[model samples]
Target: MTVTFPHKTLPWLLIAPQLLVTLIFFLWPAGQAIEQAFYQEDAFGLSREFVALENFIELLQDPYYYNSIGVTLVFSMAVAVSGLSIALVLATMADRIIRGQMVYQTLLIWPYAVAPALAGVLWWILFDPAQGPIALWLEYMGIEWDHFVNGGDAMILVVIAATWKQISYNFLFFLAGLQAIPRSLIEAAAIDGAGPVRRFWDIVFPLLSPTAFFLLVMNIVYAFFETFGVIDATTAGGPGQSTKILVYKVYEDGFVGLDLGGSAAQSVILMMIVGLMTVVQFRFIERKVQY
Candidate 1:
């Protein structure tokens, strides 16, 4: 029923369109960033000067840059861990529901469809110190909930927003993985006198490791780069740069500060960091992740 292209040249020709798209869209932009990183151009683009490694050197020397790195590391870990753990728990509970399973899945997954900025706004409104219901309740409890000036509070707010936004996505994957697992295994384990907790730990959890590992990597990457809109719409990396993650810093420096070279250098550095992290994950984590 299907036609096969046996010739290598034919296969290449068949995939040429996708290859061209990748080259034009991904490779070209990456190349431009690398080129721009080594050059400093005037704000107006009237003058351009080559300054090899100077931008990177300055970033290394800047204390704020280090602060951003620390903030990003903390933010990424918080987002990834919280999101994945909550999603997994929800998925497990959903799997057990004999009734209203579809309704529950739909309710859990609908949040992922919301735009990042909108999600951030929703959380922001919920935590707004002046009018937010949660904030009012916290105030009643004698805890002053103001992320405006408190660095730790700001970090927690952003982390909560990011984690909430990401949970729906991780939930989707985890639910799918749970569904794919054979029901026979759980039954057999029960027959072997394995209780619910033992059955889940020994059977279900092990089988879901692949999906969990994949979600872990994707969640980290999302927190690193994709949560820019969330941060921008909610905190704008403000409160004295308390929640200024690396990507937000890049945007602030390049677009607002007009430091094109510095931003490009930051972009390049981020690419390298992400690449190294992927490599490390695939090397070590992937081993523990069963197929």
Candidate 2:
């Protein structure tokens, strides 16, 4: 038996609130950013002049902007790969456990409740060169871990913090995906003399492809945007802007430097980049990712 909405007005009314929110929150701000990108205004907004593409032109010539782009790409890939890989392993182990699985899952998932900035702060404390326990241990190992002075160390710090926060989210999805796989498939593989590793690669991994693809896209987006808080808290885009991902650069320039027009241009560029990534995922990657 098929059921449909009784009234046309009811369906529209049901979705109107969500549509209104999207328009107000996303579309409206995006429009403002585009408009602002084409104008040059004083920090206090006392004077304004239209200067189309000038901000973008300057950004293109800025070496630091290029550096930020490179940082963003590296950070996004690192966070996504590390977070997904860690989460998948943990989820697989949890799924295989016949006992205390609930306890393990609860512990794994609770990290998701921590705020991104807080997570960054926690890592900062752990890696603080002066008093951090990890830093002390690293010193004992003859490896210096001062993020305050080393660009590479700063990047590693932020990446670790971001990945740590996201692992819980990826774990939840992967665990669900693993559980949805049929046990009969594995049993059949076992009967065929396949070991656990071989069965996982042949059956379980292929079945989990869809979930992995979804997480990849999500983790990329999170690294690009949501990680701003983590980077800001941990490194303030510092050790000479090495940790400055595009989103953090946008914030640093707009709020701290008060370059509104330039910041708006950067935001527009970022939006285009994210749109292109999404298109690429659907056009190319999505086709190859099994459903």
Clashes of each: 0, 0
- lDDT per residue for candidate 1 within 59-175, as digits (tens), equals 999998988888899999999999999999999999999999999999999888888888889989998999999999999999999988888888898998888889999999999
Give TM per candidate. 0.96, 0.95
Residue lDDT tens for model 2, 141-199: 99988899999999899999999999999999999999999999999999999999999
Error of 2 at 181 (Å): 0.4
- For the record, the alpha-carbon RMSD of candidate 1 to the native fold, in angstroms, is 2.3
Error of 2 at 17 (Å): 2.3
Instruction: Identify the candidate with maximal lDDT.
Output: 2
Candidate 2, run of 10 with poorest lDDT: 3-12
Reference-based TM-score, model 1: 0.96
All candidates: CA RMSD (Å): 2.3, 1.9
